[model samples]
Target: MNEKIPQQSLKGCKPEIHYPCVWQYKVIGMERQAIQAALSKKLGDAPYSLSESRTSKQGKYISLNLELTVHNEEQRLHLYSALTADPSIKLVL
Candidate 1:
């Protein structure tokens, strides 16, 4: 279970994030379609928004902004792990 720490104590340790809140991930990869498929496969029925971000001048790489609701730190971290594990995904922020 996740315990909430008072705002005043946030400076002493980990930053406090309310659960079931929207989270964002910046996904960088070579192809937009591959990233989209990976997101769809991993998220399943979860609702999310995916948009184009920066792209290399030579068109070798691109970044996509991903926004979705994450219930807790575990789920958030799990998503990051799964995304980074994909071969089509180069980086996740």
Candidate 2:
């Protein structure tokens, strides 16, 4: 027998986000240069700001805070997906 999982509704749970707004993404990676290279390859000449957020306790990883203006939800999501899919990027928040 197969069991069906209930789906949750987001009717009133999601926060309202205005389009063409600046969005911040925290990207974690093993190396800063690699992360920057990956971002550059993915984002091309798009305007963005990147800065060091924090370093891991052991100093094996680094997190970069990237801020960019997204035109819409699709653009935001697409960039998130691209960043997350990069080999150098370990996580995106």
Candidate 3:
């Protein structure tokens, strides 16, 4: 199911970003395998790095830091939206 999240309004001017830059995203989920699977499905054979960030106090949830190069704003936002919408992903930052 696709869930709609309330979009946050920008209060100030957006920051300038150079194109074809490396971007990092912190993804939280219940299982690492599911998260990896989701990422693999969406990102194909793209060169990226994934590292363990942290785990919940009870060790129930896991957060992974994902770093990848994005060619443009559209690619970055599209990946963010896709990851956030995935059931395996609890949150993305």
Candidate 4:
């Protein structure tokens, strides 16, 4: 006869986690390098990556794609707060 396993036998299973949340930023009156530096400082030693591009309509603005490899939702919130606090950063998306 076949027998079924008891409940709680699969307690070792772990849920999956997503990494490197993608974020975009709209920054005005700031150079690419300056934004990068500011982000680097805010992230501390965690080592995040960024991509930047420029767009013009009525004036010049720089768009940045930020990647955080080891940050959670709360951490992401903090990062956004920090970036927005900077005078050079016009917007965070």
Highest-TM-score candidate: 3
Model 4: lDDT of residue 39: 75
lDDT of 3: 0.96
The true-versus-predicted C-alpha distance at residue 47 of model 3, in Å, is 0.7
List the candidates' TM-scores in order.
Answer: 0.84, 0.86, 0.87, 0.61
lDDT of 2 by residue, 17-80 (tens): 9998999999999999999999999999999999999999999999999999999999999999
The lowest-lDDT stretch of 10 consecutive residues in candidate 2 is 3-12
RMSD of 2: 7.4
| Candidate 4 lDDT, 1-93, residue by residue in tens | 898868698588754556555544554445676777777778778755676655657546777777655456676667778889977677787
Each model's lDDT: 0.96, 0.94, 0.96, 0.68
Model 3, position 26, has a per-residue lDDT of: 99
Model 3 RMSD, rounded to 1 decimal? 8.8
State the local distance difference test value for candidate 4: 0.68
Cα deviation at 40, candidate 2, in Å, is 0.3
Question: How do the residues 1-93 of candidate 3 rate in per-residue lDDT, one tens digit apiece?
Answer: 997745575455588999899999999999999999999999999999999999999999999999999999999999999999999999999
Specify the highest-lDDT model's number.
3
As a whole number from 0 to 100, the lDDT of residue 80 in candidate 1 is 98
lDDT by residue for model 1 (1-93), tens: 999868787666866899999999999999999999999999999999998989989999999999999999999999999999999999999
Report per-prediction Cα RMSD to one decimal: 6.8, 7.4, 8.8, 10.8
| Model 4 lDDT at residue 54 | 59
Clashes (N, CA, C under 3 Å) per candidate = 0, 0, 0, 0
Sorted on TM-score, best first, the list reads 3, 2, 1, 4
